[model samples]
Target chain A: TQLLEQSPQFLSIQEGENLTVYCNSSSVFSSLQWYRQEPGEGPVLLVTVVTGGEVKKLKRLTFQFGDARKDSSLHITAAQPGDTGLYLCGGGGSNYKLTFGKGTLLTVNP
Target chain B: EPEVTQTPSHQVTQMGQEVILRCVPISNHLYFYWYRQILGQKVEFLVSFYNNEISEKSEIFDDQFSVERPDGSNFTLKIRSTKLEDSAMYFCASSPIPGYTFGSGTRLTVV
Candidate 1:
């Protein structure tokens, strides 16, 4: 079984702060995706990183895939209240099934 | 943007009762999936359906659980006998490409 382990399960920061969430796994993945979920809602796709050492940016959020494709990271720059939510990283392998990390709960207070 | 939608945002039932959860995925999507997340737990894949048949399933999807795409538009998950442990948030998702588009989800509470 493949598993993605996320670190810093809970983060509380003030507005304008920068934070990074990490997802690591022992198995390599073909692609990795980041998602943000608000209360009472399903996770919404934020970005997907397919190539090794790839980096993608969406507004204030930045996602990076490790060179080995076994890990990924999400960095939020100048986070605001709107950025507060549960962040999840999903790893896709050859089986076509997405294995998700436990997730990081981030709270950016104004 | 196209999205997946689910009905009966919440349902409460007694143990041993049967329940059916419905979902309508993006019209043009070819793959559909069902997932569940227990309170304070990570989301887990229950089953994946493609071409009107189950392509993959997890151990959690036992004899009590089944999935079907009755028509072109609707996908359903039926629980033959609900157990107290079945209480969780059930999410329906669809994929046109790789990443999935997930529905808001249905909260199932089995008493």
Candidate 2:
């Protein structure tokens, strides 16, 4: 079984602060995705990084896939209250299933 | 933007009763999946379906759990017998490629 471990399970910062969350795994992945979930709602896809060393930016959120495809990172620039939520990183391997990380709970206080 | 939809936003069932959770995936998507998240816990995969069959399933998806694409659009997850540990938020998701769209989810409570 492959496991994806995320660092700093919980984070709290001021509205204008920046933060980064990391997801790491020993097994290589075919693709990786980032999602943000709010209270009482399902996860919303934020971005998908398919290729090794690929980077995608969505407004203030930046996502990066590791060169080995075994890890990923999500960086939020000047986060806002709206960005507060649980951030999850999922990895897809040879199988059609997605292995999800424990997730990082972020709270952006205004 | 199309999204996945799940029915019975919340369900309360007896410990030994059966429960069926329904979902309508994004119209054009072909793959479907079920995941569960216990309160304050990580989301864990249950099963994945494609071409009317299960492509993959986790250990957590034991003998009591089953999935079916019965028709053209709806996907369902059936639990033959509920247990106290079954209380969690069940999410239905679909993906045509690697990016998935998940439904609002159904909170299942085994009383």
Candidate 3:
């Protein structure tokens, strides 16, 4: 089975600080997506990257897909209290199933 | 934006009792999935349904667990007999192909 390994299981930073979360895998995927989940809520899609070496931005957040389609990253700039949540990275493989990572719990204190 | 909806935000059931979780996926999406997350853990895939039939299921989805798309809009998951270990947040999701939209989830507590 393919597994997406996420690093920095937990992160805590003050407002305006920048942080980056990473997800790596050995198997290639057709698409990679980033999601943010708040307490008592489901994951909300942030961005979807299909092509290799692609970058997509949403406001102060940036998402990048690796050149091999086996990894992805999420970078947050000027983080705010609202940015505190669990960040998950999932990739759709050949079977079209999204294998989600363990997630990075980020806390941006004000 | 359109989103998936689930019923019973939270439920408490006795162990060995039957439980059913319901969901209404996005109107236009064709693929549906069920996922579970234990407290302080990552989400785990339970089952995927397409065309009113199951396409894939995880080992965690054992004989006691079943999925059904009784109507065009509603997808359901049933556990024949609940267990203490079954307590978790159950999420339902739908996607046309690539992007999946998940529901707020139902918190099941089996005691």
lDDT of 3 by residue, A19-95 (tens): 99999999999999899999999999888999999999999999999999999999999999999999999888644
Output the lDDT of residue A31, model 1: 94
CAPRI rating of model 1: medium
What TM-score would candidate 1 get against the native? 0.98
* Candidate with the larger lDDT of 1 and 2: 2
Q: How do the residues B1-111 of candidate 2 rate in per-residue lDDT, one tens digit apiece?
A: 798999999999999999999999998898999999999998899999988899889899999999998888999999999999999999999998998999999999999
lDDT, candidate 3, at B1: 89
Candidate number that wins on lDDT, 2 or 3: 2
Residue-pair clashes per prediction, in order, are 0, 0, 0
Candidate 3: regions farther than 4 A off: none
lDDT (10s digit) by residue, model 1, range B54-98 = 989999999999988887899999999999999999999999777
Residues B1-102 of candidate 3 have per-residue lDDT tens digits of: 898999989999999999999999999998999999999888988888888888888899999999998878899999999999999999999999887899
User: For residues A7-44, could you state the per-residue lDDT of candidate 2 as single tens digits?
Assistant: 88999999999899999999999999899999889999
Clashing pairs in 2: none
Per-residue lDDT of B44 in model 3: 89
The number of the candidate with the highest DockQ is: 2
CA lDDT, every model vs. true structure: 0.93, 0.93, 0.93
Q: Which portions of model 1 miss their true places by more than 4 Å? A: none
